[model samples]
Target chain A: MVEILYFAWVRERIGLPREQVETNAATVADLVEELRAREERYAAAFADLSALRVALDQDLADFDASLDGVREVAFFPPMTGG
Target chain B: MDIRVQSAPFDFGAEAGAFATGHDNAGAVVTFAGIVRDDTGSLQRMVIEHYPGMTERALEKIAREATGRWDLKDCLIIHRHGDLAVGEMIMMVATAARHRKAAFEAAEYLMDFLKSRAPFWKKEITGSGTGWVASKDEDEAALGRWSKE
Candidate 1:
């Protein structure tokens, strides 16, 4: 099971901060595709691929990044920190 | 390098004064502080969220990078999360180096990276409603200057 975490507005839209997913997807994009098919909220939160940033196991990662052996993933909008 | 991520408010003057006092080897010291801005007077507070472990790791990594790139005597980064009222300090960066140029440049680099690469997100809450502060394109652009082309 891979842990999926959401943050900020994405969390607000998905109505969840984190979830566990049992998936056989090979990459972050594939996992996203699977989640998008689960419900309208997931689809809406991930509607625009350009607006989202993905991280695998707490490191910055691309959507096409391989998820082999990865135990955690996160999705969020661009950071506005300082 | 000293890095702090706290929800409690920090005393800016005391922190800055303390940071300046101990750098005997450093000829120049630079400090930068970011304040919650409420230009229209509508913002009640700004809530900042962060990925707990990653935030500290990211900050430390950035601090390490700055130390490597500059001849810095010391550096400090303090950022606050949770509810922050307008005029409150959000974060501060202090750098001490042998020369003014290195001190100034490293501090700017740290600020630029913290604004874009760090994992924190800010949301503005006002009487009208609440909304996330979108990342500025200029901030992303600011980081490009630090990268070697």
Candidate 2:
């Protein structure tokens, strides 16, 4: 099981902050595809992967990154901070 | 190096002063504070959201990179979260170095990286509605020069 977190608009669309999911996904991309298949809201949130950024275990990571032994994942849009 | 991510508003002048005094041997100190800007004249406030643990780590990494690239004596980064009105200071970066050039350059590097790399998200609440602030392509483009140099 891995903890999945959503932020900003992603959180707004999904209607929650974080969740624990049991999955057989091998990579971030596979997990995304699995989440996308869960429901329409998840589909909407993951509709365009390019519009999102993902962090694996608190470090920025590529969607194609392997999920081996990963405990936490967070998804959000590109930051606009300064 | 010092990094602070909090929802509480900070005193810009005081923080800047302390940072300089803390590194008296440094010949130059540079500080930059980002203010909440509402160009549409309809903004109510800006709500900043951040990933708690990741925010600090990302900022520290950025600061560490700046120090590695310059002769920095000390560095500080303070970014606020939650609701902020127009004209309020949202964040500040201070860099101290042996010379003006290094200090200025390092401060700029921190700002550019913080603009894109930080895990903070800003949402604008306006009279009409609320919306997330879109990340600018120009901000991403700004980093290209840093890597080349």
Candidate 3:
């Protein structure tokens, strides 16, 4: 089980702050593809990757990174940190 | 280390003093406070919204990274949420180190990362209407320089 989280406008667009999913996603990109196929809301929330950023295991990371054994994935806007 | 995300206002002097305690060898303490400014001229108040779990984790990561990069004895970060009046304290960062340079640089680095890399969002209450505060490209550029340097 992998915990997926969202923040900022991404959360507002998806209408959820977090969810747990079972997946065979090899990488973050694969998980994103799976999410985009889940529902219109997910697709709309992830329509533009350029406007989004990803963190794997609570650290800033690229989407191409593998998600094997990863327990958590979080998505948010290009962080306005404070 | 202490990290707080709350609606209450913070006292900078008191917070800094607390972090500097129990470290007799620490010779310098640097503090940075971000105030709710009506810099946009049209903004009357600001509402800061954040994801509860992820926001706290993100802040902790930033603080940890700062600790890794600098030789620091202690650190404190406080961020306010919900509605804020102009000139109210939005965030405060305090760092204690053996030298002035490390304390000052680490404090600045932490603020830079906090401003551009955190998950918190702001909505400006203006005469026009309440709208999300747009993140500036300049803030990203500022943070990018740190990585390159």
For candidate 2, what is the lDDT? 0.95
TM-score of each: 0.98, 0.98, 0.83
lDDT by residue for model 1 over B20-92, one digit each (tens)?
9978899999999999999778999999999887889889989999998997899999999999999999999
lDDT tens per residue, model 2, B21-131: 967679999999999998989999999999999999999999999998896999999999999999999999999999999999999999999999999999999999999
User: What is the fnat score of candidate 3?
Assistant: 0.61
**How high is the lDDT of residue A1 in model 2?**
99
Q: TM-score winner between 1 and 3, please give it.
A: 1
| Best-to-worst ranking by lDDT | 2, 1, 3
What is the DockQ (computed on Cα atoms) for candidate 2? 0.92
TM-score of chain B of 3: 0.91
Q: Write the per-residue lDDT of candidate 3 for residues A1-82, one digit (tens) a residue.
A: 8999987778888998889999999999999999999999999989999888898877778989999888989998875545
Model 3 residue B73 CA deviation (Å) reads: 2.9
Q: What is the CAPRI rating of model 1's predicted complex?
A: high
Estimate how well candidate 3 is docked, as a DockQ score: 0.52
Residues A24-47 of candidate 1: C-alpha lDDT, one tens digit per residue? 999999999999999999999999
List the lowest-lDDT window of 10 residues for candidate 1 chain A. A51-60
